[model samples]
Target: MSRRRVQTLPRASDDTVIPDPEQRHLLWARGYLYAREPSEPPHPWWRSHELGGRTLHFDPRLELSVARHGETFVAVLGIAVDLSEWLTGLGDIAEMLLDHRLRSRSAMIRALDRVCGRYIVIDGRGEHAWIQGDASCSRPVYYSTTADAYASHAHLLAAVTGSPRHPRFPDPNGLGKRTYAMPGNCTPWRDVRVLTPNTDLCLTTGEISRFFPRSRIEHRDPLLIIDHLGPLLERQLELLTREHRLLISLTAGLDSRTTLALSRSVADRVEYFCYEFPEVREGRSPEKQQDSEISRQLAERVGVTFHTVPMPYRYPEEPLLSVTRANATLFSHPALGLSHLTSGLDDRLHIRSSHFEVARRWFRRHGATQIPVDGKEMARLLTEYHGNEAPFVEEFDRFYALTDFESTEDLCDQHDLFYWEHRAGTWVPHFLAESDVAYENYTIVNARHIYEWLMSAPHRLRSNAAVQRGLITRYWPEAMEFPINGQMKEHFPAQVACAPDRASSRNWSMSGLAASLKQFLRGNSASRHFR
Candidate 1:
């Protein structure tokens, strides 16, 4: 099960291709070379080959096709669905191409239109090539360039090119760390670059050209937007239900609660899971008890089997290594604790509202700029309430300074899409940042597909804003009604806020400093129990 053995594949050529100690396999055929390391165990169902004038290989579990059409050739990597109906849909697409009823371009578009999962297509003739995918950008696809050729896959490309040892940047560790922290699923090394989702890249005469720019959904009414979402969600739930058992991570929060309710409406005997911290149970606070009670009540109302997992006070040894290896950032105390609590579930479906924050930001940017007087006054009041928390204010300001706060236009510049015809590029950077984090460790089966479909659907700025505003109103009415800004006043009310938990052996000093500073600068004071 070691990465090395799993990455080894029979070479197309007679001579053995020696892999670098750190590098995995780099197989070449046709006009391109495909390389990757076995980061995880090889799935028994996956397949790969260096044939048909092309090198197509994928690790773990993946489904792909490399076929020719007239003078052009196409390579497609698709999600392996478990349902027979879904498989039939895929077979139909393939059959269309074989029957000559759909041309290569038409077939590619048709396939994408029907595919509700993560996919990539590499099409080309001679030395020219192009790549395209659906809007979600769920999968991580990176590439790099060396003196000789361009490569993709962070670990494999870096090891093979020895670019890490170049005089300009002789430290591979530093380069690796930088690449690791990048937000997108794609990071073309130096000369190589990631292709934006909803985009197409063409390579001709050793030069890469962008054929399609990022596209955005047109604005529409809130009800219409929800009408569209309703079908996508229903279809996605139906697809996901193919699993033997469905497990949902339910919280008092609206996102998961809505998902759980919807799933229950469709699936039979769904299992629900909740996590409770010991500190909350032993707390001498009525508010904490009420919060816990609300979650318990919801689970009872759902009328499904429920399991409560108690969070441990301390994290396991080497928490950083575990998190870093998993390619995760932004480790909230509760989420980190839940990671341990839910470690036992092997085939569980984790329906969460982690994307709500991004959705809110998107809504604010598009429309919904009217912050109610109460909300605005509440923000100002809370700002004054915690004004005395200087330490927290100072810390937050420091961290905010380190962040890249450039307008969306500036971010578009980074991807060379500032002037692109479509506004799709505007959201690509954002999607890449969020999707990169979400796909870091999880193997999302149907949820990812649903996300892709949502990304492609048309929506007006107002509609997007409405979906967010409606969600907040429906789920977190208390937060909207109170609109407290300062955490000190919000959590501690009249009492002074206490220092964060810094006694844990797993505490990262830098992280603790950042957290403390965030509270100070934002005029909010609160402590996470797991910190």
Candidate 2:
């Protein structure tokens, strides 16, 4: 609803106290301040809009004061959450407060333990706090004690400090480049780090607290996990569905398909949209045509109100930069192109089609289960077609080395021995990385993580492969039997018709230029230029 801040100052002695202490003298300070129209409010605040919900009690007579102690100041925060009785199962605010108390032991911890939803607290008495809720994390809290007042939303923080309107004034290069905010989290200013999900912070004694640990869902079975997910997703839809009308970017792909199907199940009405580039259609082989036809037929059969948005393959080069720059914070080049394509729509539920196959292939290739292929050999395979371009080969190696799989491999060795043996264990971390990256890339994000989780849960529950098969069977049963009996004609037709074209001089030239252009545009600008 509104941004809130809690500022803490030292408690002065009875009579002989200096009223104007230097701004630097204060030890701990934090508070919540928010601005919202009396009408449309943001979430957890929206929950309290009615008379039954919590309302802000503004005290005009209360003078804004700062107190100072030796080196530390203490401030207590009282945060209130407004929820109807029906929504209590979704972690009521009071329950969160109680849980915070149990998890945090110190006085500063006790103060933060009371505040629920998304929050950031800094006590002049030597304490700091940050927290978020379970389903949605929309509230943004940022701080900078470098200025006289440490404020929550970035713009407000700037306004209060009389600083420039730049989002990067404090840390010009770093924060400017990182734009997408993951739902349900906080990224404090440069000096103040995140407290992590289900965690709290108490700067007083320089101690951070954990209200909940990462392993809370460790023993959950597929059905139980889905039960949790169904409600969480339902809550998200309910919140987004408020304006009645909704738009979905649908495709033949699984991610968007699942989102469209789910939205159809819940929303009273819906409008489905898709982007069809003529170039893709014009060059389409028989199989590609078949896929496109199937997608059209499926959308029609589902009775969704469908609209096709046609975007030409070519555009002026300058606008490309503007489009890509808009999304630089969230996506890399490949993803930035897609985001630019969807930027024209006003749909509330902007669905994206993403798959984990790329990450899966990377892991499967590198993991022990696969036949051992030396990095040099893979590098050769990747570069042989591009002539003897040392630079291109070097860049390819760097890209592969930078991926999360390199680190995940180490983690797999240490903690996922069972998965390593069973050939199924990299699912959680793999899916998390994939989902987080996708969310960062798109504006309104949705994915198949729920299904992926179901598929990867313990064998006694359901394998991740099973979920994939089930979805395929449930929606497109007709295509299920096509590859039966080793039918190469139907399933491997593309591979059969294809002959590797020898690389021409022009091909080599384009490859070099693409590589160089890519390198030149490194960072956000590069992604925007190409995308």
The prediction achieving the highest TM-score against the true structure is 1
lDDT tens string, model 2, 120-207? 2223322232332211112223333343232223433443444443322232224232221211111223332222222333322334
Residue by residue across 339-452, what tens digits does model 1's lDDT show? 432456543444433333222233224232223212222222223332223332332232122212122322122111111211122222222222221121112222322333
lDDT against the true structure, per candidate, is 0.36, 0.31
Cα RMSDs of all predictions? Answer: 15.9, 18.4
The TM-score of candidate 1 is: 0.52
Candidate 2 ranges with C-alpha deviation above 4 Å: 1-127, 131-213, 216-239, 284-291, 314-316, 319-323, 329-344, 352-456, 459-464, 468-531
- Where is model 1 poorest over a 10-residue stretch in terms of lDDT? 487-496
Please report how far candidate 2 places residue 161 from its true position, in Å: 15
- TM-scores for every predicted model: 0.52, 0.41
